[model samples]
Target: MMMIELLKPDYIFESSWEVCNKVGGIYTVLSTRAKTLQDAFPDKIFFIGPDVWSGKENPLFSEDENCLKDWCAYARESDGLKIRVGRWNIPGSPITILVDFTPFYAQKNDIYGQAWCDFQVDSLHAYGDYDEASMFAYAAGKVVESFYRHCLSKKDRVVYHANEWMTGLGALYLRKHVPEIATIFTTHATSIGRSIAGNNKPLYDYLFAYNGDQMAGELNMQSKHSIEKQTAHHVDCFTTVSEITNNECRELLDKSADVVLMNGFEDDFVPKGNTFVARRKKARQAMLNLANKLLGTKLTDETLIVGTSGRYEFKNKGINVYLESLNRLTRDKNLKRDVLAFINVPGWVGDPREDLIARLKSKEQFTTPLEVPFITHWLHNMNHDQVLDMLKYLNMSNAPESKVKVIFVPCYLDGNDGIWNMHYYDLILGYDLSVYPSYYEPWGYTPLESIAFHVPTVTTDLAGFGLWVNSLKGRFSELADGVKVIHRTDYNYSEVADVIKDTVSDFSALSAAEIKKIRKNAAAIAEKALWKHFIQYYYEAYDIALRNAEKRLAL
Candidate 1:
């Protein structure tokens, strides 16, 4: 085999819908890895995002009116571009530009027409946020092209990386307008794959039999799928977050990934020694106090605080499986110790439960259980919610008679959920164990975040993180290794639930020293996943992208 020479870019521009916006898992991927990229390139890296917070305060962004002063003025005059330059409030504090794409909506048709003419991207069947996301993407590409023309020399090597299908238009636009600039398009998850899974179809079992274009049309994903497939085929490099997602790209996008860019995390968000202990203690106390007040029964420290949290995807995130497992745990007559399962998934909550708030404020234990004690907050439609319906179906009333109690925290834990009044990390540190039984996770971050905080977690083999754990041990992972890789299949929902119940029962029965050892091991696993260790893969990706760009330019 001939040896491959490594190449690097002089400048890198990464555009995503989540750059300054914290939407989903992609935000975690970019924010946590920003510091590592900044250390290597200094001020050479720039992040492009949509300017949603035009006149409002964006806590994640620290705007600087003078950071890109001359370029901003020149671009506005020459290209009609609207932008705000700032530093993202992440570890790396990388330079970020939030583009105002509102003005471009009027010209969406012309832009979509050009995209179809140049790259064969089919936006004719677009609906909902498809037009909005494409406008942002097109605006981002324009921003990069204008900046390159005004600031950089033609001889300089540059790379433009767009993340997810939402930004596929940007990558395609960059490749068309500035053919000299290399481009990398990463699909964290394919549109058709997600649609298939979300609609209760078996994505994995029937993956090989499905045609990308045919499925796109049948599933009403034509517009997003067309752009993603075209960008993947046209870009200098195509990448995905994991081996599992790469397979999805091959089967659904008709393209094999140039690289599998595993997501990495920074440990700077975790608190240090004494602070960590203090926060954990405080979190546990608050959790127990609220449980006591809501259920009218005092829960001791020894009660196993189990949790499952993510987007409210009833099936995709395995919320149904998790609840079913909890339902089983609640009725297990042999289970001796108490287990408090918290569903921290945010929903359409209206306000905090006033009765629970009043009870907590009075510093008095309630003699009677509050009405509808299962949820911490008041939801917009409590009667019609799916989670509530499931709980009702399981008859989990969190009464004084049950050995296991389940609580629903239906609001984001951003230090103002009105109950915990703590950040998610602070609140999650209180959990003795976390469970993430995902059905369609491209790269699981919640489980990784749990282990990072020294909380042993349960995840299924279907998740990328769970597969990584299995790779380390070459067998089923157990609680002793800081994780339990439960064997899950498309049809093994009940089996997975049984496994989770058994795992939690076994964990609750462990001795103090054994639990401490497991916690230590969990932290060690997180150490292996830090950005410092995983940054090397990014370097590998950058090299592949640059070398491919060189070959294209040569032709």
Candidate 2:
């Protein structure tokens, strides 16, 4: 085996779905990874993304008025795209560029515009049809092409790393024009999986229906499967967030990625010791209060507080599966433990069908005035007219148990809702067990973050981290009892409920000595899986790309 030296590229361009504008795990990866990239290859790494408009003027770009104008003009005239270039001065390193192509983004009907919008919408809070998204993607593609052209002439060996299908277009564009340039494509999650999980559609119908040519022409109509296929086929070297996504690429796109680079955590930010304990205690107390108000019974310390938190879509994030498990657990007569599930799923109340169903079932509910108001308010906001229809529909099915108090915290919480929401750390520390059964997770950071916080996690095999965990099962099994990996495919509602019941029961069975040991082991595992260790992989990936490019040059 050859130990490759850290030969830094003359210039490195990283285009991610989220850079300054963060909507998901990619944002955290880009933001935290920047420092490491800079430290390893100072003044060489450049990050490019759409210049999302901010209410306040950016000081970074404001300082470089003339250079920014010159770059913009050059990009427009030479590259044939409207581009805004902003620079961020990284301490002890090269400047990071924030690429703004809002003008191109505004032209949603175009090919590049649609692509940009599709990527940004995944991170943006608001939701709309695909016209805006299609235009966004098209504009993004144009802007990326312009940026690549602008940076290509610079005297360093150019290394381009594009994240997800959204930015993969840039690498594809480069490959067509400059085949010698080192291009690496990273698929966070496969489009096929995401679409099937998100859109309640059959896999075959979604995957085979739309091809790249067809998708490039139509904005929102093309399936995610097509976008992923295009990404894999075009990039020079392909990388995925986890083994799961790698497998997905092989299965769906029939193209295997070169590497599996798992996502990682920043340890310094995670709350621990007194801080973590205090927050957990506060969350427990809040849950107890909510339970008392709902079931009219004070929750005891012995009560197992099973927590599940994520963005509020029931189908994709596995909220429906979670609810079914909870329903099954409540029906278990043999189960001895008093279990209470605290659901921190945001955007649930906004869903019409689910909200209507919840409201209808509440009529026979035993919840108190305080609890009722909160639940009803959430329901009303979600769908006012449909709620009445839901009440009528629930007359047929059994009412949800009052014991399993499902408290809906509809808004985004920061340190106030059971735990601090400092991106990853705060959210992970809030629960004893974090449930993430995502149907389409490119690379889940929640499981890793949960383990880091000494909080146990249960994630589906569909997730990237879950696949990684399964690979390290022997190591994980030895580390702690805190984390539990469940194969969602193996179990239905009842089986999942049994597993949840057993896990909670086993957690209760643990002695104080046992719990302390589990926490220590979890911390150890987290240290080994930190972002610092993962940063090395990025350099290695670049090395691979460069070596291949060099070989091509020699030939």
- On TM-score, the candidate that comes out on top is 1
- 1-555: candidate 1 lDDT, tens digit per residue: 997766878899999999989888899999999989999999899999999989999999998999989999988888999899989998889999999999998999999999999999999999999988999999999999988998997788899999988898988888878988999999999999989999999888889998989999999999999999999999989999888888899999989999888888877878989999999999899898988999899799989999999899889999999999988987776676899999999999998988888899986767788899899999999999989999999888886878899899998888978887899999889999999999998889999999999999999888988988888888988889999888887888999999998888888789899999999999999999999988887778888888888898789
The clash count of every prediction, one per candidate, is 0, 25
What is residue 119's positional error in candidate 2, in angstroms? 20
Candidates in order, TM-scores: namely 0.98, 0.76
Candidate 2 error regions (>4 Å):
1-7, 56-96, 105-155, 178-180, 198-224, 286-297, 300-302, 333-337, 348-403, 414-428, 475-480, 490-493, 551-555
Q: How does model 1 score by TM-score? A: 0.98
Candidate 1, backbone clash total: 0
Candidate 2, residues 347-438, lDDT tens digits: the string is 53442233334433453433433434324224444454322233233331223344344544554554433222233344446455567766
> How big is the positional error of residue 25 in model 1, measured in Å on the Cα after superposition?
1.0
